[model samples]
Target: MTINDIKNLLNATVVSGHQLLDTEVHNACGSDMMSDVLAFVKDQSVLLTGLVNSQVVRTAEMMDMVCIIFVRGKEPSEEIINLAADRGIVLMKTSLRMFPACGILYQAGLRG
Candidate 1:
């Protein structure tokens, strides 16, 4: 699925990277622990996370994720947004919880 597909699937709001909303995505992993996301995620283009910190962006960068979704209405700080913007990562927010967000994207045909 594309980033735009995810946004449509979850009714997410773009926090940054408006131009990148059309980027494609293959897989998704949801976690609050940056360490777990870093240690295990592979070939995942989208990260559905509750952690709203710069480390989240950094971890997604390390894992080569194309987008980071803040679930349950979480928001990233300016520092996190800057980090993501610099890394060419798209940032989005959704009111959906992590599991449902992942499910929505998965049901929409995203796979790792």
Candidate 2:
């Protein structure tokens, strides 16, 4: 599904990479642990996380994740947002918590 679809599905706000809302994502992985994310790579994926820090952006970069969804209304700082933006990564904030957000996307056909 497209990043736009994800944003709509979770009623999220685009914090950065607004121009990339149409980017396609095949799967999603929700995690607060960067270690787990490092252990696996999902192609054309989005990282759904509650960790609103620059490390999240760095992990997404290392994993080649196209988008980072900050769960449970967590919003990253300006530095974190700029880092993602500089890397051409899409960033958004969703009110849904990690589990529910991941479930919604999964049920909508985005494999985890």
Candidate 3:
């Protein structure tokens, strides 16, 4: 699914990268641990996470993740958003928690 599809599926609001809504996403990785993400994620374009920090953006950068979906209604700090914006990474937030958010995307055909 494309990022737009995920947005619609999750009822997410874009925090950044509005111009990148059309970007396609083949897979996603959901985690609160950056170490796990770095250790296991492969070719995943989207990250569904609750950890809101500069390191989240940094981790996405390292993993080449195109977007981050903040679950559980969590919001990324201004610094985090600005960091993602600088890297051309998309950031979004959803009211759904991690598991259900991942499920919604998976049900919509995104895999990892």
lDDT of 1 at 13: 95
TM-score for each predicted model, relative to the true structure: 0.95, 0.96, 0.98
**lDDT of each structure?**
0.87, 0.90, 0.94
Q: What is the lDDT of residue 58 in candidate 1?
A: 83
Per-residue lDDT over 40-82 for candidate 2, one digit per residue giving the tens place of the 0 to 100 score? 6656479998988899999999888989999999979999988
Higher lDDT: candidate 1 or 2? 2
Using alpha carbons, what is the TM-score of model 3? 0.98
Find the candidate with the highest lDDT and give its number: 3
Residue pairs that clash (backbone atoms under 3 angstroms), model 2: none
Candidate 3, superposed: residue stretches over 4 Å from native: none
Error of 3 at 24 (Å): 0.7
Tell me the tens digit of each residue's lDDT in model 1 across 59-89. Answer: 8888888899999999788898888899999
How high a TM-score does candidate 2 get?
0.96
- After superposing all C-alphas onto the true structure, candidate 3 shows an RMSD in angstroms of 0.5
